[model samples]
Target: MTSTAEEEVLIGFGTTCYYLVFRLMITTTGYGLAALGSLIVIRTINLDNAKSWREPKSIQLLCSLIILSCFTGYIILQAAHAFIAIKAGIGGNPVSLAMLLTDDIQLFLNATIILVGDFVICWRAWVLLSEDKFWRYFLALAMIINIGINIADPVYDVPNMKSELKGVFNVLDWLSVACSSIVNLIATSLIAWKAWSHYRLSRETSIWRVGRQSHRARWVLLLIIESGALFLVLQLFALATETGSSFSGSTFDKDLTFVTVAKVAGSLWNVSAALYPLAIIILVHTNNSPIEETYYAGTQHTPVSLTLLGNMRHSASGGGESTAF
Candidate 1:
């Protein structure tokens, strides 16, 4: 079918918006990579100081490095493929099934990134709530379910990329989003609760006579909550955009606006997911202080103590050595 003048104008606008979003994603990806790189360096230094490669902490750092490397590589490759496809005249053209397949691949990569992110957050929750097996099992179950949904999505979506099946795909996609959102919300709440509980316990026991140590612990907790909240807000925005596009599917039959919006939302969501962990690592790094470490040394392990915040050595005298989260 031939395009109307109005439809042509809309397509042009959609294409412009897509490219703008594309540029934004690239910029965000660059920042994310830089942050990840710095984290790797800092972590490596910490590992060297610890002088033990066999420790669980060292293994965790190694795994994190590997995941960040893979995530960065995938983002670059997907961005390049997107640029090439658009240059080959596939931009804003949803009817091009091959281009659509490329998008599906990107979606799969995004799901992988999100899976890694979810695992990281869940792991943090597990450590913070180490004594609570119920919360640990709950978070583990949620992470598993979320990962299952994410893995199932691309498998179901790629094969059924038909106009008639768009709604079905939307349902599957949103199902995954809903699972992830729930997991994030629950985990963040648990972390916040643990932090607050620890603060209250320390106050009641007079374990923290000086307000400075308690203040630092609260700062760490606030940083963690803020980071989680930021990521959740971005995911919610992505979900909103997807819902809007799904609802407007029929009105914009050409699918330009919907396609552009979906791509933008997906890209932003992945970028935010990648940035969240990096932000947490950097925040912990910057907040590390020699004075704080000395003061915290000889401190008993508490539920929401700095030890739970990062990797720290427990002194023989029930204190803590300098650590990074």
Candidate 2:
């Protein structure tokens, strides 16, 4: 039988291997999905009759490209870091290993991706609520708070940082998650409300008209909810992992599960965050079916005035303005 020390070493080695494989798989898969999503978005934009290279849709495409590039950079860095750790051996000091894994570069990239994601979501919220100052101000405030917190996060990344500082770091991380969740939740609610309002107005116009518009409005609402739900779930998972690891102390064996969970959740979060905007763009472009035109056209005959917000800006001819789905 192997000695106790030998068995412990084996366990550590096994854990390290598991981490590397898991990271590699998730990172690669996530990146591939983001790439595919980006391509679809670009293709959809190209096919759009109403949008042009000089339009706001083009700007959104640019933003998506930038976000995806950042995510790619982050994954590359993470892969390198994991390899280095494998070479260093997991038998080293757990605290130092943890600190190395959560290095300055990684934190910076994460904060950057998250900040961009927050901006995209908030921008959408602003466009949707441009007419309503209350929601616009509320979302603006949330974005400001989230951005400030994200910018301040990198400062606490010192080598062998103090326990008090670590506590502060954890607090900042949790605060960011909380603020982001609030922003997403509020933004999604507002968008859904607007879609519901449009649907209601369509129903009053004509049954056949409402049937066409209802399908398109439902799709828009679904996309918004899906995106928001994705972020909220990932953020909650990260928050739980971080909280658990922080309270678990320096025991590597005890903290391994928490750390692993956090890493996986983070990988998925980065990819999903990048893809979120691209997915939105593609969905909006695909939603330009005859149903949309019918819905908008029917609105002209109805006494009710429906204001379509965001990328759905179309000409006011008999057809209602095209809405960004």
After superposing candidate 2, which stretches have Cα over 4 Å from the reference?
46-55, 90-102, 158-169, 207-221, 224-227, 250-260, 288-325
lDDT of 2 by residue, 1-325 (tens): 9999989987987787788779778878878888888777777655244345545556667777777788788778778767766766654644454546546677787778778777776766555564699889988888888788777766665443434443333566566666766777787677666656555644544333335554766665555543466666776776666555655354531766668877787667766767676665565556632223222221133211243422233333335544433
lDDT of each: 0.61, 0.63
lDDT of 2: 0.63
Q: Which candidate number has the best lDDT? A: 2
Instruction: Give residue 156's lDDT in candidate 2 (0 to 100).
Output: 62
Each prediction's Cα RMSD? 6.4, 6.4
Model 1 accuracy (lDDT, Cα): 0.61
Best by TM-score: 2
Instruction: Tell me each candidate's TM-score.
Output: 0.70, 0.74
Q: For each predicted model, how many residue pairs clash, with residues at least 3 apart or on different chains? A: 4, 5
Q: Write the per-residue lDDT of candidate 1 for residues 1-325, one digit (tens) a residue.
A: 5569768866665675466458556646655774665466455435444456655445446545655665666656566555555555444453565556666776776687678777766765665676789989988999999989989988887766654554333576677887888888887787677656755654554444346574776667554543387788778877776665655346533476666666666667777676665554444334442122211121133432555334322332356543333
